[model samples]
Target chain A: MSGHSTYEPKTGFERWLDTRLPIIRFMNDTALDFPTPKNLNYWWTFGGILALMLGIQIVTGIVLAMHYVPHVDYAFNSVERIRRDVNYGWLIQFMHANGASMFFLAVYVHIFRNLYYGSYKAPREVLWILGCVIYLLMIITAFMGYVLPWGQMSFHGAVVITNLIGALPVVGKSITTWLWGGFAVDDPTLNRFFSLHYLMPFVIAGVVILHIWALHVPGNNNPKGVDVKSKADTVPFHPYYTVKDGFAICVFLLMYATFVFYMPDVLGDAINYVKANPLVTPQHIVPEWYLLPFYAILRAVPNKLMGVILMFAAIAVLFILPWLDTSKVRSMRYRPTARLYLGIFFLACLVLGFCGANPPDQPILGHEPSGFMLLDADINSIVWLSRIGALYYFAYFLLVMPILGLTETPLPVPEGISEPVLSHPAAAPTGAAAAPEKRG
Target chain B: MSKMLRKGLALAALGLALIGGQAMAASEADEPRAPSGGWNFDGPFGKFDMAQLQRGYKVYREVCSACHAMDLMYFRNLGQKGGPFYDPKYPNPNDNPYVKSLAKDIQVKDIDNDTGDPVQRPATPADKFPAPFPNEPAARASNGGALPPDLSVISKAREGGPSYIYSLVGLGFNAPVPAGLTVPAGKYFNPYFVGDVSSAWHGKGPAPKGGFISMPPPLAPGKVTFDDKTPSTVQQQAKDVAAFLAWAAEPKQEERKAFGLGAMIYLFLLTVIVYFSYRRIWRNVSH
Candidate 1:
């Protein structure tokens, strides 16, 4: 993709800057004239969508920080004041709040697209690892941002998550105390969280630059999962991808705006509207929807330490996925058996999220007091359901990725991108025999 | 298809079946689900009815305000765009005479500038809605340890919003208390309230539908007279106040929806244009 620079400095000022910086030439090589696989699909557009979401969150967040108060007493009221008094503050705040959910949605799609195409394999492992780092930062950033409002859920969610660290052996309690800046999640905690919340997005942005730079090295992996072999198999990224990504981005924005305007708080917990009270805890405390799968994994095991370890392991496992997968072929499109396992893996993650939202004792199968016990807990309960989901979640990586990849027979892959694109019936008029020439 | 894929699909189908079955079989054992129906502001196109908001305000002022506080609200909010008393001619809500007059009726605690002493003053349009108590401790003390939540965003603060408010206040009291259910001294039974009533229920088929709520049934027939001459039944008052709470929760809702329409149209056109351009640019490349 970065074979040779094609940009020329036509103007006097451009030539001067080209000699000094050559940033114009860099942008041209990476973003404009970079040779990308022509067969990339809508799934590829999520990269651009995620970039747009990060920008939206940062810009809106900076504006929110201008008026937001970090003190526990004033934080709740200040947020309300922004909504009630400041001009278009409601719009800005809602966009920022809902933008977090939207950001996660796009990132999940992008991650899944990578998995399906084996984009994490071989030369692209560093690119995938950089993405994982960004994701971890995003989770921390979103968690801290939720605490800034000093709502009931915000306070309790912080307490619950921070306490998970205390499950460790010796230094756990000390670490928790240090993190809180006191004995519990209090004013000091809120102040530090607000400061870090403002800082984390910029950190995520820095990592994102590395992620993109790593991406440019190997370019994009298309749906075909085949490497671009010749000039005919590729197209200039500028007009080819820019317009397609722009179209997809507009459609995504339409959905985002619908949520921002019509049902801004649908994704948010209603309990969050209540101001934080140290004495009283909410009956049921759940993390934001995006983190539910991990939360479910945390609660699935009965042992506290083991559950914490397992939850962290779930994400840690993804970092080593490139090594776990042993398939010679990259794309699931050519691997029928692996595709099924991946589909089940997808469903398992969704089930875990569903279970996470519910209480551990609540039934997901038989009625309550049914006397159906599976080990220590009821077989009917959400804990059992989550355990099953978590089991499959772990197995998908450790078992399916390692075992199925070696055994499954992949469908024969095309030699080049143009072979399948030209041979496909949709590419030409119905009556045509041989593939037609590329349009001028 | 491979044997493994078939087995995976079978497992997925079985799991889906169990989930679907549970979803249909799950009973409302904790509290009755709040019924949401016939509200003017129900959907994407829904807008607050101004007259209904005015009536709702009367109910809030007369009833709920005695215990609850709307600390986030200001007198100017009532006269802002999409508010009950909004006037297009008066763009600035602070300049709206109706809002000013309404604010003047309430006495707010303040400090005397020169004397350095506490004083009571007539509230201005800019003033926040006065709380019923001086502080949370006092409020809880007065209400028998049950703190009345702020009503500024009550509609968005609860699970079902306006519907939950209406049900808990208006219809909850109508349900007959199950035999052997012990109501707490200060708490009244409301079927729409969420709680574990198993301890209090000694003689029930499965403990009743609801739990003990601190607030007694607040709305009554003819509790507050509407200025618009609408009938002042308990149901009507509850509905009106709920609508008012919804508007108070997000005064800019109508404005948001209105803006969303223009945004949707613009995005739709932009998408269409971009889509066409994308097609044209990639026309030569089959993939």
Candidate 2:
């Protein structure tokens, strides 16, 4: 023990770190060292999996940048060259492209994991807020990166998004001009977007570091919502979690690799293959899969500026999730009412994503199509779904969380650590009883 | 218990045999075919004839370097000689030398000279193919308003590779008008011009049934010698050059296929490992 203590650094960089960044040490002691509830199922592994995905994206993205050209004229062709010519360029490009989808997949799971566990509660509020911020950044980065290819969709997307700024009251035109770097979305726009897309990932990496830091502050919230009381409740993260996370990462990679190699462009838009043509517009302009919910929300509002603002607010509201839920319990396993509503809310989000990806439908509320007819029926459907999704998206935060917090939660108190673990068969009855208790 | 274990082992072996048999069958089915000399102009064509492609590569190396730059392509990729696809083993030994020679030949601007005037001898491989013109005005003056686009992504940028090149080169005179417009004395146009049709062309005389293109057909009728001793014609040379351009545009074809195959194998192995590992870990535990 004495010898082990002596191994600790006494001076220089270690000493400096000890003083300035006590948070890491503190985290290691309190949250990491703090015993975790033993009943955390596979769902809890998603957060670790999500972090691994972020790492994959960053690594693959860096390698892709080595071969990718940023020029509008050459960007799409360069991508083709990478697919066709560069040594193992196809693998790198496919990995990056498919990795985007995988990252979203993991994030969706991670978010759902948080919802299921109520990990957004109390002291972990900052962690949850940081996660929301990271999600928004991810959306922005993906969107901007999509435009770098200068494909038909990319051009239209830029036009649509930049034009959204023109919907503002006073300095709209100036702002649009400033954003475009010209009167229209042209070469300068592509160049600047390329620069920013490259830069934003680094920013996201920094934020992720912060997000993980915040997570470590509270450690992990377990399924039971019961705080750990002793050493018996927890295990060291090095071997146990290291192995678990590693296995999860490997499994995730296998799935990712399958898609990357076999069906790389499954998630991509076909229109993106065609070069950007300002004169001839594509039949459809869909945002990436990740942005579907927000895209739906953007269409939900009638007013342009208001819709944009609402869309921004929808994401911004997620940052305040820590404060919104007044629930004493951390995990939805104990909070039965929160569980059901959260599940429904999750389903609603999925529906919104699906609808957003689909072509918008004509609004049933109106008698005739608008005179302008610039906006399509698909936009209308997206708007309605957006409105509903946005409403639900907010309701889950503002109304549902607070309401569920006040309501009674049907919970089963677990026996001591040595009690026989309940298998799925044994847990069935408990699950059945827990059904009606899902109030939110 | 021992008998039961042996039975389980036998079953596992049988499953492995089945899988192995299937994979063998698949591999046999996917074998690549040697290039055929039949040059079909219509429908899909194999990327290009490998022999003609190699000759075209040589031509590009020797002659085209004087005026044109394939900035999009790498030197070593030409060695994907067996097919239109690239092979990593065939490294371009001339890459460094070619680049150095090019650099020595041309004078790119340093901070001292921002205008970027070429300094001395002609450009070497290291130098960016010196622009035909220093600026937009110079380029227009030299190329008759049409800037020679970078050859790097040209194969991808254009719709059909060989036919486009062939048509672009085979310009001479205009065909008889379809009763619409009064014809000029010397000017000619191609009805099948897929690209900006309005763009002007420059050929010496009346073209074949198709409209005359501005670019005078560069091939001297029977220039490129084919490997199978196929008729060495202008059309053949055009096909060869187009194939070379296509290969240059996308050199990773073979590597992608190889990696894709490898990844599938790895995934199959991974799946098996994970399945066994999961079974091992959960063997004694009751569900």
Identify the leading candidate in terms of DockQ. 1
Residue A374 in candidate 2 has what lDDT? 29
**All candidates' TM-scores?**
0.92, 0.62
Docking class of 1: acceptable
DockQ of candidate 2, scored on C-alphas against the true complex (2 decimals)? 0.07
**Candidate 1 regions off by >4 Å?**
A421-440, B1-37
Top candidate when judged by TM-score against the true structure: 1
The true-versus-predicted C-alpha distance at residue B262 of model 2, in Å, is 3.0
Report the lDDT of model 1 for residue A98: 97
Q: How do the residues B1-287 of candidate 2 rate in per-residue lDDT, one tens digit apiece?
A: 12332232123221122222222121111111112453332112223455666666654544344345565554334434434323444344234443344345455443336556644554433234444445656654664554455565455454444445444543222224444333344334444343222123233332222333333334665554555676766555555666666556555533454566777678667766765665564454332
Residue-level lDDT tens digits of model 2 in A188-304:
888888888888888988988888677665666776655555556655554455545556666777778767765565678756766687876654567888888877676555556
